[model samples]
Target: MAGLFISFEGIDGSGKSTQAKQLARALEQAGHEVVLTREPGGSQGAEEIRSLVLEGDPDRWSAETELLLFTAARRDHLERLIHPALAADKIVICDRFADSTRIYQGTRSGDLRNMVDQLHDLVIGREPDLTFLIDMDPDTGLSRAKGRGGTEERFEDFGADLQHKMRAGFLELAQQFSDRIRVIDGTRDIDTVAADVLRIAREAVGVAKSDA
Candidate 1:
């Protein structure tokens, strides 16, 4: 509870992963202990689950099934990496977290708010101290993602409509939790975006250190 738990979230190609890494490096350079991790794959077992969730047969996996799989991996990640790092008072930077489920699964599946809420209550008992939501147009993100020429994962393979919904969901979530979440313009230059993320994280770290 004394450590800072930060999560970065956005649609594909929003550059949150890159920002998260940079922030972690900056914190380390400032003489702070840091733990960089990601959801759906942080621990050994969770990584395997991540493969199933991302590279598995899409037709075979229903919405509920996908939700469970994501949560399963998250639970393992929490037990193995996240919780221990927090206990050691290390700044934990995660690429994605439970909000992803609410945006991707809950929005895509429809009427899954209750499901997301229940999972949050049961599994993610502690919320991130700060959540940086890198906001960008779905079309732009998808174009950049495709231009990268990488193998498409399950989520990446989702149709444009679903991606749009997910983007909207993220924006809504940010609005609802404005005090704990900061919505950054992901379409900005990488350095600019990184600077913004760092500023937010620095403030959060200062508050957390003071509270400790």
Candidate 2:
């Protein structure tokens, strides 16, 4: 809680990883101790759970099951990595956090959304000081994803329909958390996007420190 926690979120091919890395390097160059990590996998145990949830068949785990796995992974990540780093006053740049879980599972409808909220409030109450929501067209994201050809292709296999839904979900989240979520335009070239990310991140980090 003492550190500045930032999370980058977007659809599969929204370049969240690249931008996150760039931001971490930028912050580090600015003399800040930054820890760049990702969700479902940040710590040792979480990485193991990541493989289980990401590599297998998409339907291998039900929505509820996946939620449990993600939440479990998050708990370990926070206890083992995030919380300690933050307590030491390190800048933590997370690729994705609970927002990913909220949108991914929240799409299932009914009480699932409520469940996510309750679980997060009960177990993972913390939120990023700033959230970068890379906004991109689902078509563009899917195309980029296809070009990657990675084994972690389960999410892409869901087709454009799901990607559209996911995009909407993220955008909706940006509005909901607009005070903290900066919806960055992800359609531009890599450097341009990174520049925008760094600018906003610097502003947010500065403001967070000022508020503190």
Residue-pair clash count for candidate 1? 0
Candidate 2 regions with alpha-carbon error over 4 angstroms: 109-111
Q: The CA-based lDDT of model 1 is what?
A: 0.87
lDDT of 2: 0.89
**lDDT leader:** 2
RMSD list, candidates in order = 1.2, 1.3
Model-by-model lDDT, in order?
A: 0.87, 0.89
Please, what is the TM-score per model?
A: 0.96, 0.96
What is the Å distance of residue 69 in model 1 from its true position?
A: 0.6
Question: What lDDT score is found at residue 191 in candidate 1?
Answer: 88
**Candidate 1 local lDDT, 5-38, one digit each (tens):** 9999999878888999999999999999999999
Question: Which parts of model 1 have CA positions greater than 4 angstroms off?
Answer: none
| Candidate 2 structure quality by residue, lDDT tens digits, 1-212 | 58799999999899999999999999999999999999989999999999888775767777888889999999999999999999888899999999999988777434488888899999888999899999899999999998998677776877898889989999998999988999999999999999999998889788868876
